[model samples]
Target: MVRAEILAVAVVAMFAGPGGAQSMDKATDCGYQAEVVAAVQQARKDRVGERQVQQHVAEKATWPENYNNAIPLIAGWLYGSDVSMRDIRNEDFAAAWKELCLQQ
Candidate 1:
């Protein structure tokens, strides 16, 4: 379970984009990478908006520290799927992204 969580976190972080250092503190505080990833997946499926994604991210605030390293992979997948930050905000993309990273 732990390993899977790490992988998920890695994958989500890969596509989460740059500028993650600023969020390290929050990621540590949240401490639940799986929850984050699940939220992102749900957000994408729900066709969420960017502002919502920002709000969701803000709610967790600390996801970057745990998943930032995987942003490239996550971004590639999201880009391939036409899931933009704007669209993701409306859903749980932020949480899902963290969950995905936990898998790695």
Candidate 2:
């Protein structure tokens, strides 16, 4: 429940701009965003600490290098205090995030 609220806020913030309508037209961008979410989920499942998530992801990054810039931001949310590692490991957060992103 808490994770859902956080995800909502994050998605809303991402689209909070005058050009948000234009951005929504490019749903392809969310594909990479989803990939980032998946990677972070894997990191959590692998027992990687939030402090090491950035480096850990960079080391085994499969997503495009351009998307590397978003690792820190996504990592913060996945590893934030409000979210538990258990939630990440047990839930399909990457899929949920992608669905929400596409719905925009």
Candidate 3:
């Protein structure tokens, strides 16, 4: 799963055309948010994992600590809040990502 996610991100970065870091960040954040939301929706359907993401317009925020990629953010949220995906917010992503790291 991680490998696939990384590949997807890389492919997107490759064909996404050159842009300022801000544009790249916006794209990355959007992609990351989508993945996280999918996990939440999946968990809701599958009845597994925590659901802590709150559905809302997440205020722009930096990536979580000890991680520089979008994958970790989604992974962490899925692992931390199993069977309980809520609306995702940038503020809560770090804690979720931490859980994913520690648990895995």
Candidate 4:
């Protein structure tokens, strides 16, 4: 029940990014935003540890091969970071993931 609710919220976040981010070429340019949204919600799921969320994303996220590379970083950002999910505004996360790509 809870999982379903979170998944729904994740879907809303993906499409309803601030100021209609879906129109931008930079945001979700590679189509991994769905994966990111799902992973973010999964990372926050009740009683589901980060390890499980990481593993789930690693296996399930399908996009540029970088998904496996980015999932851990995404998981870390969503789970272990100081930025609360409530505080993270739309399309902000794409920049964070882009930073990881820049490092690699």
Candidate 5:
């Protein structure tokens, strides 16, 4: 019974109105955003650790290869749009920005 209730709650949370997280401005942009997020989320769920996620994000956002440096750019916009989008801090944002944008 407890497990069923938990499953129900998870379903409700998953299907909740789109008002909670920052909605992507453009629908087309959501595809890549979802892809990057899924990668990070999967890494976290696999217990690869936050450092692993950071490294993966870094490698994924490298220039002239994947998305031409769109991952962290999208992440920054998402961060600005929704404070609760992720637990990432300003320092993380800065590092990502520098690595993906400035150093690219």
Candidate 6:
């Protein structure tokens, strides 16, 4: 998945308008972004269906409610054919996501 897709939800919330300033702290937002990714990744590993991933995340997420909005997008990317869930079973996507988020 593209970086934009991974960051979309958090980015949208961080910014105000076309050229408006950021409304939230980047570090905290990125951390929440990583949480969303981690939650979705775990749900997928648990065999949660794409259609059910949203609900699964909503029920279990410990992050801010706003961050949960990213669940659908993250789930779609994780469940997409291009990404093999089995192949990523051992990967720490949450850490990778946080690293990328902070770098941006």
lDDT values, one for every candidate: 0.46, 0.70, 0.39, 0.50, 0.38, 0.72
Tens digits of per-residue lDDT, candidate 5, 4-74, equal 23332332334234642235333323334345544444444455544345566656552223332334433
- Estimate, for each residue in 1-104, the C-alpha lDDT of model 6 and write its tens digit: 37544455455445334432356677777787888888888888889889999998889878777666678777767787877866459788778777777776
Model 3 C-alpha lDDT per residue in residues 1-104, reported as the tens digit of each score: 35434434543453345442335454454444444445444444455433233322122223332122333444443545442334333234334433333232
Provide the RMSD of all predictions against the true structure, rounded to 1 decimal.
8.5, 3.8, 10.6, 12.2, 15.5, 3.6
Model 3: runs farther than 4 Å from truth? 1-24, 49-104
For residue 3, what is the lDDT in candidate 4?
34
TM-scores for all candidates: the values are 0.32, 0.70, 0.27, 0.43, 0.33, 0.77
What digit string (tens of lDDT, one per residue) describes model 4 on residues 1-104? 23323433444344346543456454353346445645665556544577787676666666544435445545665665665556444345544444432232
lDDT-wise, the better of 2 and 4 is: 2
Candidate 2, residues 1-104, lDDT tens digits: the string is 55654664465455445544334444566666677788988988888887888888888877556556667777778777877767876888777876776665
Where in model 4 is the C-alpha error above 4 Å? 1-30, 85-104
For model 4 the TM-score comes to 0.43
Flag regions of model 2 displaced more than 4 Å: 1-27
Q: Which stretches of candidate 6 lie over 4 Å from their true place?
A: 1-23
- How many collisions per candidate? 56, 0, 19, 0, 0, 0
Better of 2 and 6 by TM-score: 6
